[model samples]
Target: MATGNKEIVRRALEDSWQDPGVFDELISSDYVGYDPALPEPIRGPQGAKDNFKQYSDAFEGAHITVKDQIAEGDAVATRWEGRGRHTGELMGIPPTGMEIVVEGLNLTRLRDGNIIEEWSNWDTLGMLQQIGAIPSATAAQTR
Candidate 1:
């Protein structure tokens, strides 16, 4: 069961963001997401799609690589790194054509093999700095 749970999360990470319908298969209808980037709780598969769509739309070649994963007692935690080019608008910031890499970890809880909730922590500020949306400390220091 632990391995099955882990596989489900892995498949979702690989396919769900781009194929919105995959969320329905992987995420529970009552799924809720907790993340600093989210303005409110994510409810259901559509919410998951919407959350991921922001990144997918912004980065045409975006891809997430799973660095590590662990599963226990109906829960799975995944550490991942995502990289891509800034080819479109993201969170209202226009594209800067910068290649960016962001690392994050998520802990997902499952109910009957479906993701019921997820909590994520990621380097949002670092991404912003990489895309030049915000100046880095070193860049600021030089001015």
Candidate 2:
């Protein structure tokens, strides 16, 4: 069951960035996402697909790697790292063509072999700094 859960997440992340339709197979109709970037209770599979599209649209060639995963009692946790080039607008910030790397962890809960809920924590500040939306601390110190 744990392996199945991991595979579901792996495919979901890869496919969401490449082919969003995969969500129809992996996400539960009653799915909900707890993410800081989105409003509470992000509605079902379509919501998940849309969220991924937002990131992928901002970062062309965005790729996510699952560095580690652990599952027990219907809950799976994944540590992930991702990189991409800022080729489109992000949070209204214009494309900077900067390469960005970000790391995060996601905890997903599965019910009846499909993802029902997820909570994610990621390095949004770091990505913003890399894209010049926010000044880096080092840059401020040097100024």
Candidate 3:
């Protein structure tokens, strides 16, 4: 049996890669992604797909590497790094031809190989600035 931690991580990566039918194969109907940017939690598989699509569209050639994952029953905690380039429009910002490497942690709840809930801690603003979307005038000035 795949441990809950392993299964959840596998599903999360599959979803991130924008694999067709990933959600249908591994996610629950009432999945809730605890991302700060979304006004409301993703309510279903399609909503989850939308979230993944948003990410995949923005970060082309994106890759994720898991540093560590620990499991406690149904919940799993992970530390990971994801890297990609801004090859297309991302959050209303056109391609900047910049690459971003982000490191973050996430905790997820799983049941029956389906994702139930997740909380991700990532540097959103830092990622934006790295990709040259956010104004880095202050950073430039400081430098």
Per-residue accuracy of model 2 over 81-108 as CA lDDT, tens digit each: 9899999987789999999999999999
> Residue-wise lDDT of candidate 1 within 66-127, one digit each (tens)?
88999999899999888999999998999999999999999999989899989999999999
In model 3, where do residues sit more than 4 Å from their true spots?
135-140
Better of 1 and 2 by TM-score: 1
TM-score of predicted model 3? 0.86
- By the TM-score metric, which is better: model 1 or model 3? 1
In model 3, what lDDT does residue 25 have? 69
List residue ranges in candidate 1 displaced over 4 A. Answer: none
Clashes of each: 0, 0, 0
Ranking by lDDT: 1, 2, 3
Clashes of 2: 0
What stretches of model 2 exceed 4 Å from their correct place?
A: none
Residue pairs with colliding backbones in model 2 are none
List clashing residue pairs in candidate 1. none
- Candidate ordering by TM-score (highest first): 1, 2, 3
